[model samples]
Target: MISASAAVLRAGDRPYAIEEVILDEPGADQIVVQVAATGFCHSDAVARAPKFVQVWPLITGHEAAGVVERVGSEVSGIEVGDHVVLTFAYCGTCSQCADNHPAYCETFVQRNILGLLATGGARATAAGDESVGARWFGQSTFATRTVVDARSAVVVDRDLPLDVLAPLGCGIITGAGTVLNVLDVRPGTSVAIFGVGSVGLAALLAAKAAGAESIIAVDLHPARLELATELGATATILGGDNDSVAEQIRKLTNQGTHYSIDTTGVPEVILCALGSMRARGVCASVGIQTGDVVLDGHALSGKQLVSVIEGDADPRTLIPHLIQLWRDGRFPFDRMLERFPFTAINEAEKASLEGRAVKPVLVMS
Candidate 1:
């Protein structure tokens, strides 16, 4: 067993508290990771709401990167001391996984969100021997150390900075993958992105890398808009302005964008994303919906609306491609990262909620 300090969220409405936890040995298909850092995602915030809290005394963090401390007896291709990024869990034998769509794996919700272990046991326990939901997204990386299925670990170059690369596991992949993998955004095409937060900005950066001809970014925050402008957005629209945002994008792109992406789940913003696209253009929705989305039948007359999960990305392939782009100075996702100490997890979460930081990473001490 291993002992580590973790941020424990005992209730849906309470703040995370620092506590010493006990970790069980890795299973035959699992590995132990000494987490260097974990990225804060909006989904983590969503999990704190009353309705979403299925497991009490949970340690919820999805995006993480670290060095492998131990490899299970049956683990292969991955060894102790390898650098890896922890992503969502998947059952390798499932049809979806066999088809390279692990994001849609049959047991996705069970393994990733419900915090169920394949072995039907808890990977971690609190001081009183109470089981904690430590398998969140298969990594539960809010802690300094975690035991995770080998299928969830993506090996990366040892030289890369784990803190900066942590977001690649989910948010970054969802954004960039929507453009590169799902949309197949080609050069000389126009695109529009709604809600320029970390995910939207990542999409913007991917669009730029894909050689998009015109990129329009729409957001409610002027500060984020300015950052978008700096990060290669050809045009920016104030989200709720009296002017029609879709029309503005249409005017900028000589009719409408060939593609659009909505990172904000707001119903109105989604409508604008649909309206901003040209005939037959596709729009990918990657955000968590807060309320029901009531769509007009006419909205689908000539366009397509796709609900993308994890950007339809195969992480093993996409992450390396993104890393190469970063090395070539093409995909600079680092600009969106803000590092915080693991002990200041509550502070980091507050910053993320307040928009004081784009991507808050918790670095283990």
Candidate 2:
């Protein structure tokens, strides 16, 4: 096993501690990636909370971009020195994967969420040989290094900056995928995006690219709303600016938006997003919910709510598309980024948790 400095999560509601850990070599079909950069996403943050299985001593950053340091004997089409982005783990042999929906791969929860690596053992350990949970979402990129199944990585052009493209694995893809890949959005369609965070803003950008006619951005943070407006939102609404956010949205769109998306998992906000859509309109939620979302029986007459993961995208295809979009100056998601040294992980996490930053990318020193 090789040594690397890693952020160890030992408790819920506690800060990450930098500690030296033992990292194992890649088994066949897996590769050792010297992580170049990684993004902080809400899904990674949720592992710290107690609701889920509190697998302590876990290494927990998933949005990874790195270079291949070692290639597995069984892996192909990838080689050393390739720049890659780590995506959600999927047992590629599963039916869902065969259907081209790796996001919903049958083993998604077992592989990605459960922290189960290909070898069914810890890839990292503590000083005295204590098992440390590794492979969180197939990479656990919180450290300076990681080992991942070959299928979880997508090689990108070397010229692309890893800092900004890192988030495409999850956040950016979720938003854009839901818009361009999942929903029936088209040119001149009225759409509204709620929350205006990474996911929401990504949706805004995608909607603009899709030629959405009226894209309304809703959020409590005026700054995020303004940023959304600058990105592509035709209008912005302050969270407290109206008695009813749905009413404001409906009134603004004449009847209501033809479609809407909620990146804020707040149940109330989710309901509002559902309410803000026109008849037969669809609403998608990318946020982690705090509680149940109950809909009005009448509102359910034609409106539909869909829960999506990883934007329902096949990473291999979607990530490359995003790269092309970025190259064409269509998707400028980099404007929402801020960089931090890998050593300042705790401070970075704080900035992200408290809403002080939109997309905090940690650079490996």
Candidate 3:
């Protein structure tokens, strides 16, 4: 086992506490990643909920970018010292994984969300061998070091800064993927995105890349709406200004948009996005919702609801595409980042929760 510094969440409603712990060595198919940076995704906050997470002292950040320090005996197609971005876990043998949709893997919840390794044991231990739930999303990346199966990562360009690329693993991918992959927004098409958070903003940017003519952004924050416009939203709607956000969207786009994405996960906000869709339109949801989405049956009049996780992305292929887009100046996701040292994680979390930062990257180096 290797000693490492990590931010531990002992309770859902409390801040993470930095502590020293013992990280177990990589199993046969795992690799030890020396974390350079990791993004604080909203999903990490899910691990703090007592109703959702059963593990104690869990480490939950998943969007990690780092270097391979050591490889397990069964590892292949990866090597030591390679730059990489960590992603969600998947069981490679599942039908979804075999068909290139690993995000929907049958064992996804068990391997990633349950905070348990496939073999059913904790991977980290504190003094006196107290267990710490460390493998959240197969990464637990808010640490100096982590062990992951080879399938949970994508090798990235060595020259690019890991901090800037980390969000590609989850937030950026989910948003952009919903646009480019799931919705496939085409030129001259119209789209409405509710919630101009990291995911929504990424969707807006992807809509621009897809040549969407009427890209609308809806959010409560004026600052976020302004940023959305700067990032390529054709129109911005102040969520609270309108009597009905869905009506405003329909009026703006001439009888609703062809595509809509909701990143807020609020039931009311999702209803608005759903209502703002054209015939046979698609609405993709990427937010974390605690309550059931109670929707009326009449709302789906030829409209499709896509409850997607990870934007239906296979990280291995999508990460590189996003990186290339970044290099080509098409995807400027880095503009939404606020960098902080690893020690100041609580401050970063507060910034993210308070909407002061769209994407907060914790630099571990």
Candidate 4:
């Protein structure tokens, strides 16, 4: 058994307890990663909600950056000492994955959300030999080390800052991928992003990198709006005036934006996003829904409302593209990052929820 120090979530209403746990041996197609850093994401927050959690003692950090410490016997194309970013798991043989759309893998829910292990046993155990759920997004990275499926690891250059690149796995990829792959945002196009959090801001950066003529950002926080404006949002809206929000977007872009992205997951905000799109424009919904989206019969007349998972990205390709963009100084995603020690996981989570931090990265001690 491998020993690891992890932040364990035992219940929805409780704080994460940092404890030493025993990790199972890597499966034939899995690898052991020594986590350097991990990002705090909204999905982790959702997993903490009692209604969404199907199991207790779950470890749910998904955006992880690490160095491979061990490779399973059957693992290929990756080796120990390689720098890697851990992403959501997918069955490589699935139709969606075969088509290079791993985000829509048929077993996504079972593998990513359920933390299912093909080895037919728990991935880790806490004190007293109690089982712990740790395969979250194929890598329960709220720890110093983790076991992950080989297919979910994307190897990157060793010289890159692991702490800053940690979020590329999920939040960053989700936003950028939706714009570049799903919407095919072109030069001189217009886009409006709802919610200027880490994900939304990532979209803003990608839109700017794509040479979008007009980039609008909407959020409830003035600080975030200010940051968005600094980071290249052509305009920023305070986001409470639902009726006027769409009208304002239309007036700015001559006839609404060509594309829009919703990362707020609030039903009203989603409607506002749809309303801010021009006729036949596409709006990608990537947020975790808090309430049901009740749409009017004519709400989607010529506009398209799409439910996207992880920006329809194949991490192998998109991650490298993003890295290149970053190297070119066209995508400055690091402007939104804030770091905290791994021992301060609770503090980092609180800062994320309170909007004090945009992308909080937990660095291993």
Candidate 5:
């Protein structure tokens, strides 16, 4: 057993607390990871919200990069001391996995989101045998140490810094993959991204890399618009002024954008993106929508609306490609990161929610 500090959500609507927890050694096909850095994503907040009561007493985190401390006897092609990123866990035997789409694996609900242990047991026990859940996203990365399935751990280049690569597992992949894989954005195509957060910005960068001639970024924050321009957005739309946001995009794109993505998840913003798409144009929804999203069936049918999960990417392939783009200075996603110590996770989450931080990473010592 090993003692580790974890930021745990004991119950819904309660703040996360740093607690000393016990971590068991790796079991078959499992590996123990010493988390170096973890990204504080909005999904974590969503999971902690009262509406999501699926998982409790859980360690909340998903986007993480770390070093492998030990590998289980049954694990292969991995070793101790390997640098890795813990992405969504998948059962390799699932139909989705067989089709090269692990993100859509049927077992994702149990293997990653629900914090079920490798042996289908609980990860923690409080005083007098109370249960404390771990294995969130198959890594429980908010903790200093987490046991993860071999399939959940993707070995990355050791030369890349964990602080830089951590968010690539989710936000970056979701954004870029939506453009490259789901949308299949082509050269000279026009693209518009609604809600220029980390995910939206990543999509803008990918669109630019794909040789998109006109890339428009929409957001209420002017600062984010400035950053989007730096990252290769050809145009910007102030979201607050909806009077001509769609008109401006139409003007810029000649008719309307060939592809549109909504990362805001707001009903209005989604509608705006759909409205801004050309006839039969593809519009991908990559945002997290909580309440019911109302839309006109005619509008959606005319626009070919679609929802993308994890950008419809195969992480093992997409992440490395993104890292290579980063190395080439074409995809500078690291610019979005604002580092903080693990103790300040709550503050970081607040900053991210308030738009003060594009991507906040918690560094563990």
Candidate 6:
């Protein structure tokens, strides 16, 4: 057994104080990780909201980087002290995995969303033997130490800083993969990205790398728009005013953008982006939005629209490619990060929601 400090959400709307939690040793097909850093994503907030009552007292977090401190006997290719990134868990025997699409594995909802350990039980607990649900996205990495399935951990270069690379697990991969893999963006393609957060900025960078002729970035924050331009957006649209945003996008792309991606998850922004697409143009929605999306059937039929999960990428392949791009200095994802100590997780979350920080990484001692 090991003791670690973890941020626990015990039936509250927000994450409360960090408490000492107990972690068990790795079992078969499992590995113990000493977390170096974890990215504070907005999705963590959504998961804690009332909408997600399925899992309670869950240790929340997904994007993370760490070092393998111990490995189960059944695990292979990974060893102690190996640097790694913890990705969303998947049951490799599912049909989706058989087809080489683990991201869409049918068991993803069970393995990752439900926070079940590989042993099919809880991996963490409080002092009184009460469950402090772990295994969220297979890592529950809000804590200083995590035990995860060996399959969920991807070994990365030890030379890279964990804080800087942690975001690559989710947000970064979702955005970049949507453009490079899902859309298969090519030279001369006209693309418009709605919501210039970490994800949208990643799409912009990928589009530029693919030689897109025009890259349009739509966002309310002037600072984000400026960053979008610096990252590779050919044009910027202030989306605060809904009516004019589409018009400005149309003006920049002439008839309309050939490919449009919505990362904001705002209903209005999704609709605007759909309307901004040329006839039969592809529109990919990568944002996490709840509630019903109301849209005209005929409008959607006229323009092809599709939703992508994990940017339609296999993390094993896409993450390495993104890291290579970063090494080449073509993808400056580090510029989007704002680091904070793990103790200040609440502050980091607030900063992200208030637009004060584009992306926040919580460093663990």
TM-score of each: 0.97, 0.97, 0.96, 0.98, 0.95, 0.95
Runs off by more than 4 Å, candidate 5: 117-121, 126-129, 241-243
Which is better, 3 or 4, measured by lDDT?
4
Q: What is candidate 2's TM-score against the reference?
A: 0.97
Residue 250 local lDDT, model 1: 85
Query: For each predicted model, how many residue pairs clash, with residues at least 3 apart or on different chains?
Result: 0, 0, 1, 0, 0, 0
Give the per-residue lDDT digits (tens) of candidate 3, residues 1-365. Answer: 67789998888888888889898777788888899999999888767666787678788899989999988888898999999999998988889999999989998888889876454324788777888888898889989998888888799879999989888899999998889889989999999999988999889888998899999999999999999989998888899633488888999988899999988888777778889988899999888764677778778799998888899999989889989998999999999999999999999998998999999999996
Q: Point out the higher-scoring one by TM-score: 2 or 4.
A: 4
Model 3: which ten-residue window has the lowest total lDDT?
115-124
How much does each candidate deviate from the true structure in C-alpha RMSD? 1.3, 1.4, 1.5, 1.1, 1.8, 1.6
lDDT of 1 by residue, 61-143 (tens): 99999999988888998999999998988888799999999999989888888876454335678987888888788778899
TM value for model 4: 0.98
How much is the lDDT of residue 203 in candidate 5?
Answer: 96
lDDT tens digits by residue: candidate 2, 1-365: 66778998888788898899988777788888888899999888889767574456799999989999888889999999999999888988889999999999888887888776455335688889888888788878999888888998999989988988888888999999999888858998999898988999888899988899999999888889879988989989887533388898999998899889988888888788888889989999888888987776675668889998889999999999988988999999998888999999999889988888999999987
Give the lDDT of residue 137 in candidate 5. Answer: 72
Q: Which candidate is the best by lDDT?
A: 4
Q: List the residue pairs that clash in candidate 4.
A: none
Residue 279 error for model 6, in Å?
1.8
Please state the error at residue 180 of candidate 1 in Å: 0.8
Residue 335 lDDT in candidate 6: 88
Runs of candidate 3 with Cα error greater than 4 angstroms are 119-121, 241-243
The all-Cα superposition gives candidate 1 an RMSD in Å to the true structure of 1.3
**Model 6 poorest 10 in a row by lDDT:** 114-123
Clashing pairs in 3: 12-48
Better of 1 and 6 by lDDT: 1
Q: Candidate 2, residue 112: CA error in Å?
A: 1.1
